[model samples]
Target: MNRIYLPLAASLVLIVSLALVEGKMRDRWGTPGVEAAELGKRFDQVPKKIGDWVGEDLPVEEVTRKTAGAVNYVSRLYTNSKNRNTVNLWLIIGHSRDVCRHTPTVCYPSQGFRQTGDPLKHHIDVLGEEPAEFFTATFSKEDPSGRHLERVFWAWNHPNTDIWEAPDNARVHYGLSRALYKLYFVGNVLNDENTIDSSASVDFAKLMLPALNAALFPEKIADTVQSDIQPAGDAPAEEVPAE
Candidate 1:
C-alpha cells in the first residue's frame, strides 16, 4: 500500500505542475478564439498562432481593436460661413499601432507612440454626432512657453491634401527645424494663448468658396468672380440724324 500510494502522489504532483505551466503559456501567448464558421481542427490554429510572431512567439501580446480607444477633433474653415470649410470631425483613434486616422476625411498621419507625440492622443476624445461650435485642442504636456511642441492650427490651414509635393498631407509634421521660426510655430501660439484653441474655428474667409459645379451654384461664381455686364447705349439712336 505504501508503494502504490507513493507512485500515485508523484503522478498527481506532476499533473498539477503541467497544468500550471500550460496556464502560464496561455496567458503569455493568448489563446485565440475562432469564429463559429471555422469550427473544426482548424479552430485550434488561431489560438496556437495568436501571439506567435512570424515563427516564434513575440515578447508582447498582439494588440487588437479591443485594446484601442478613439477621440475626435473638429478643425474649422477660417473662410466662408455660407460655404464654411470644416474638417470631417477628425478622429484620433489610438491603437497599438502608432498612427492617426479619420474615416470620412480619409486622411491619416503616421504618428508615433503616445509617449513622444501629441498629448491629445490620451487626453482628448472624439466629438459626438451632436453639433458643436468649438474644437477641443489642448497641449498641456507641451512647454507652457509654447517653444517645444506644435499646435493643430497648422493642420487646419495646410492639410495633408497639399496640392504640392507633400503626398502625406494628412500627417502634420511638427518638425521644429523649418516650422520653428514661422508664425504658426509654437512660439506664436504662446504669445497669444487666448486664441490658441479657437484659431482654427475662426471665420477668416473673405468670401465663400465657389460652389461646386456651375450647374449647382449657377452663375454665383460669375457674380463673385466676373464683373456685372453693362448694357450698351440704345442703338446709335440719333447718330444718323447728326450726320
Candidate 2:
C-alpha cells in the first residue's frame, strides 16, 4: 500500500508541474485566437494617386497567392509620370507569424534566382510619418532566354512604435499577439542600364507609406497627423541619403 501510494503521489506531482509550465509558456508565446479572415483590411481603398506617381492594381497569380498564406494582400504597380520608373508594391497581412520566413530570400531562390549579396538594412524617414526600417536584397537569374535582376525592399510593421527586419522581433511583437503585417516593394531593373539603383523602391515607399499606415492603424491617423507638424527636435527624422 505504501509503494502504491508513493507512485500515485509522484505521478500527480509531475502532472501539476507540467500544467504550470504549460500555463507560463502560453502566457509568454501563445498566438492570439483571432482568425485571419476577421482581420482583413480594405486594400482596395488605397489611393491610385500618391504624390506625382500613379498606381494601378496588379493581379497576383493564384499559385502565388495561395503560397503566400496571407489572409489578405494588395499587389500594385506604381509609376512616376515624370520619369516613368516603376515600382511594384505588395502588402501582406499574414495568417500567422510563420509567414516571417516567406521573404524573397527564400522565395526568389526557389524560383531560380540566385541571391546576389547580403541584405542591406535601411531606414527612411517619410515626411509626416515615423521612420521606417527595412531590408533590401538583389536577386539575379540567368536562363537560356536572358538574365533578370530584381531588387526588393521589405519590412515587418507593428501597431506599436517599432519597425525592423529581425524576424524574432516580429515574432515577439506580432506573432505572440497573433497579428502580423508585412510590406514589400519590388522593382525590376532587368532592362535598365543601372541595375543597382535601389532608389525606386525608396521613392515609392515615400509616397505610399502614409496610405499604408492609415489602412493598418486607422485609429492612429489623427495622432500621426499631429506628429507630422511637430518641431524638428522632437519629430521623427529620416536617415536615408538623398538620391
Candidate 3:
C-alpha cells in the first residue's frame, strides 16, 4: 500500500510542476514586445524602385496582419522593366520569432495550392553580401480558369545576424528575441515548359536584399560605413534613425 501511494504522489507532484512552468512561459510570451504603431516608418523606408524593377505597394488584409502578429509588414508587386518578370514580395516584421509560424509550407496549402515537393534549402547569395539561407518550393493549383504554378522563396532574419535563415534555425536562435523579420517572394508565372520560373525571384532578391538590409539593420549599416570611411577625405554618412 505505501509503495503504490508513493508513485502516485510523485506523479502528481511532477504534473503540477510542469503545469506551473508552462503557465510562466505563456505569461512571458503574452507580454507585448513590439507594437505595430511603433513601426510607422517601416513602409516609407522601402524604396519603390531597386535597379530596374519598379515596386507598387500591395494591400495586406488587417485580419492577416493580426493573425501573424506583425509589428510591421510590406506587400509589394515588383515588375522588371526589361523582361517584364513579376514577383510579389512580402516582408513581415514581428516582435517575436513566432511570426515565422505561418510559412508558405503551411499557408499556401491552406489557400488551395498543392505543394509539388519538399522544400529545398538554398544558400542564396546576393550581389553585394554574404550568402543567406532560404527555403524554396514550387506550388501548383487549379482554378475555374486554368492551372497555375507559383515558385515561393522564404527566409527569416534572426536576431543574431542580418542574413536570413531557415525556420528551424530561426526559431532556435530567435525564439525569444525582441524582433524578427520574414521575407517572401512569390513568382506567379510558369515558363514555356510549365515549370515555375525562379529567375525573376532570384534576380529581384539580388537587387532588393541590400535595400532590405539598410531598412532592417540601419545601425549595422552605419557601423560598417563608418569603419570603411577613408581618413583622407571622406566623412561618415549620417546615421539612419530607428524606432
Clashes of each: 9, 0, 0
**Which portions of model 3 miss their true places by more than 4 Å?**
1-31, 35-40, 167-170, 192-198, 230-243
Clashing pairs in 3: none
- On lDDT, the leading prediction is 3
Best model per TM-score = 3
Expressed as tens digits, the lDDT of each residue in 1-243 for candidate 1 is: 999999999999999888775554333343332211122222122211111111122232234222221211111212223433232112122221122223112211223211223323111111221111221233323344433322432222112121111113323342211101000111112334464443322222101111111212233436645555554653454656655
Per-residue lDDT of 176-232 in model 3, one digit per residue for the tens?
555677889888755643433345787788778888888767878888998887786
lDDT of 1: 0.26
In model 2, the Cα lDDT at residue 187 comes to 84
User: Which run of 10 residues does model 1 get worst, by summed lDDT?
Assistant: 176-185
Q: Model 2 — which ten-residue stretch has the worst lDDT?
A: 24-33
TM for candidate 2 is 0.72
